[model samples]
Target: MSADIVFSDATRLAELIRTRQVSPVEVVQAHLDRIAAVDPKVNAIVTIAEGALSAAKEAEAAIMAGRELGPLHGVPFTAKDSIDTAGVMTQRGSPIFKGRVPDTDATSVARMKKAGGILLAKTNLPEFSYWIESDNLLSGRSNNPWDLDRTPGGSSGGESAAIAAGMSPLGLGTDLAISIRGPAAQTGIVSLKATHGRVPMTGIWPRAPRRFWHVGPMARSIRDLALAFSQLAGPDGLDAFATSAVPFDAGVGTVPDRKLKVGWMVGPGFGPIDTEVAATVKAAAEALKNEGHHVEEVHIPALERDFALDVFNKLHVMEMKPAFREATAGHEDQMYTMAKTMLSLPDTSMEDYIAAEQAAERLRDGYATYFRDYDVLLTPVLPVPAHKHGITELVVNGETVDLTYLQGATVPLNVTGLPGLSMRFGTSREGMPINVQLVGRWQAETTILHAAAVLEGVSTVRGRHPSI
Candidate 1:
């Protein structure tokens, strides 16, 4: 029974608690037990909240006293170590800020707490949440739950691993490039990278490159992602970028399902994708077509791999490094390798920075044009399935490519400030999960979610779990 409790998703767990079939205490304790038994092998969870069990007991008492409960009244969730949680340790997977604790929660964290979600713990990330793999001196690297030797996909890798292994039902993760979608894809979970400023980033670190950073939910179920997104979106007033008041249509709650125009790509245009990963995306498109949606292979312009990385690097290198340099001034030797290398790179010329920004605008224009005709664009979340930890290069579709190409499909959406969701679509030959990304126009999460819901119902990978 405890095993069953731990494996349930947040939506189902909330229903069980609301119906009195299970108490809040049972739900929290079950996951705590699962973490104890399984987390040693994965190392996904970095810090367990000191007050979780006590809070769960209080939730149980309130329910027994006939008090009304919020949507996630008793369900436990985790946040990436980079996100703020008042009074809880948020070491950010780096030794520079070890023992750090914030006095106030991030806007997203506070909103989740207000909606009755419990913060069970903080999960791991790359040092300062920067690299493509989750590892740092503060907490060792996090291994994938499906294959212990492979990576879970970083910056949000730990959150993805915990959700996949049943240690947490839902989680909050931030994405700059591929953090949320890529990690969720590698682990066979569902996650969203909402439109820029859709969710606040009031208390997150490395606040430069402010225009590109996003915080959203990563969960085992698409409905849970939608639920959590609705709770976290809207202007928090503290974050200057969160000035818009857009709400997720959710495409649920009595809206009848209808056909959607989906453009699916296995690219020679974006980057080289493994043959198997391409097939999985095509299969997902066929499933969508069978459901009466208009699915087709569409060509998009300005998707050069060079342009994507150039724009990201121009802003990331110039803007994101100085803050870290300032933060770790006295403790240079303690910095992680990737971060140390990032700070040591030669300065960018002003002319190059301007050129990259122009290229970014073209990339945005290309997506804007494509989205006008198609409701959503479908692509593989990563070029291949999770790769072994510390392995740098990959042979993708017969070409030896730099691992940075993993974000080929994802980073473009971030550059455009468009919304994208990554969900489990198929399984690899090794029995590992494969995911595909669905990109939608600005503030069109509902359209993407509705379309994904249709395909998800017919996907063979749904509800499958890692043996971990």
Candidate 2:
């Protein structure tokens, strides 16, 4: 019963709660049990909120009293530790704030709770949400459920792992570069990095390089992503970067009615993608074409230039350094590895920073122009599948590449503030999940979600789940 309960989608759980088929207390306890059963091996959920059962009881009483219900009433969800949850440990997976608890929830968390979702736990992440792997001195490393020795992808790795392993149905996660999409790709779940400013970052950590940061949903289904996105998006008035949000409807986005124009890729533009990954993406495009949408192999040469990754790397280090230094100025010894990493970065000239911003503007304009002709852009979220945990290098098409290339296909979206999603397409020979990325123009999340939902409908592997 616990296994079945944990695997049910958030929407389904909501329906059950509303219909009195299952009490919210039953739903929440089932997940708490699931977390206890698997979290030690996966290390995904770092802290279970103390009053989860009390909250569930309240939700149950509300239903019995015939009170109005929210969209996610009684559905349990997790959030990355980097996102604040009032009265819950929001340590950001760093020792610097080991006992940290916030008075107010992050805007996204607050909105989710407002919509009737329960915050049952906080998931793990790299220190300060800084790395591409989920490991830090605070909570240790999070392992992929499909392969214990491999990574699930990071920053949002724990959130992805939790969803993949059925510890939570859906959750909130932040993406600076590949934090959301990369982990989802590796763990065989789904995640969205919405258009910049579509979701607020009011109570999240490492709120530097404000322009590139995005908060979004990581879930087991695109429908859940749409549900969570609707609740999380919109200007909160606290975060200046969170501009106006467009309305979202999962019913509309998942309907398979639109004939989309999708541009598929496997060029030098996306860095050294594995041949298999490229084929999987192309296959998705072909499947969509067969479904009556236009599909073409295209290239935007700007993405191929070294400057695409270089510019992001420079700005990320520059913006993150000052904030991290300020946060840990007096206790350098207590700083996590990633916080110390900022000190190791080469100093960037003000001219370089200016050049990077200009380049970013050009990238944004280029993507905007490209979107005029294409409805969605499809690529591999990562050049390769999840690899051994703690490894510093990865093999992309037989060539060992720097670990940073893991976020290759992803950062360009941040550079342009486009909305991008990662959905599992297939699996590697080792049974590791491989996912393709669907990127849409700014404020066009529905467009990509529609296309991805269609692809998900036709996917042979969409029904597969990790055996944790």
Best by lDDT: 1
TM-scores, in order shown? 0.98, 0.97
Candidate 2 Cα lDDT to native: 0.88
Report residue 356 deviation for candidate 1 (angstroms).
Answer: 0.7
User: What are the lDDT figures for the candidates, one per model?
Assistant: 0.88, 0.88
Model 2, 129-149: lDDT tens digits are: 889999999899999999999
Stretches > 4 Å off in candidate 2? 253-258
lDDT of 1 by residue, 1-468 (tens): 898888788989989998999998999999999999999999999999999999899888988998989889989999999999999998888788899999999999998888788899999999988889999998999999999999999899999999999999999999999999999988999999989999999999867788889999999888898889888989988999898776553445322355788899977556788888999999999999998889999877678534586577776688887887898899998999888988988878899988888888888888888988988899999999999999778888689888888888788877789999999998889887899999888878888888788878998878888888
Give the Å shift of residue 20 in candidate 2.
1.5
Candidate 1: RMSD to truth: 1.5
